[model samples]
Target: MKKLSYLFIALFSLSLMTTSCREQKSTGEKVEEAVEDTGDAIEDAADDVSDEVEDAVDDNK
Candidate 1:
């Protein structure tokens, strides 16, 4: 009975560890997606600024 109990405890601990690892991986993916979205936004803003500058220069000409 004691051996069975130890086995059960060990299995439960292993299950928890696996679940925690999966959660960490999910969190990492979310962070990577956020960074990609932020990078895209920055790129868009830069493009808009460049377009505005080009328009101003054309107006001066």
Candidate 2:
């Protein structure tokens, strides 16, 4: 029983190590995510600027 418990613990630890190692994003994936985030930020900024411009034009009336 004791040997079985040790074997189980070793297998569990090995699995945890392997799964954690693979969970990290590859460099290419990381770069893609960064580009997507930047795109989202730019889009949000454009929307904000557009709203501001509309408000300014309305104020001119």
Candidate 3:
């Protein structure tokens, strides 16, 4: 019974270690992420500008 308990504990520790050692993002992945974020920011800014333009047009009328 004690041997089995030790084996279980060792296995649990090993699994925890492996789970924490996740694969890091490569350079290409990082660049892709940055580009995606920039795209989202640009889209948001464009939406804000469109809204402002509509508001100004309504005011002029």
For each of the candidates, the C-alpha root-mean-square deviation to the true structure, in angstroms, is: 8.9, 4.1, 3.6
lDDT of 1: 0.92
Identify the runs in model 1 with alpha carbons over 4 angstroms from their true place: 1-25
TM-score of each: 0.59, 0.65, 0.65
Say which prediction, candidate 1 or candidate 2, comes out ahead on TM-score. Answer: 2
> Positional deviation of 46 in candidate 1, in angstroms?
0.3
Q: Write the per-residue lDDT of candidate 3 for residues 19-38, one digit (tens) a residue.
A: 86579999999999999999
**Tens digits of per-residue lDDT for model 2 on 1-61?**
9999999999999998887545878999999999999999999999999999999999999
Q: Which sections of candidate 2 miss by over 4 Å? A: 1-22
User: How does each model score on lDDT?
Assistant: 0.92, 0.95, 0.97
Ranking under lDDT, best-scoring first?
Answer: 3, 2, 1
| Model 3 residue 6 distance off true place after TM-score fit, in angstroms | 14
- The window of 10 residues in a row where model 2 has the poorest summed lDDT is 16-25
Indicate the TM-score of model 2.
0.65
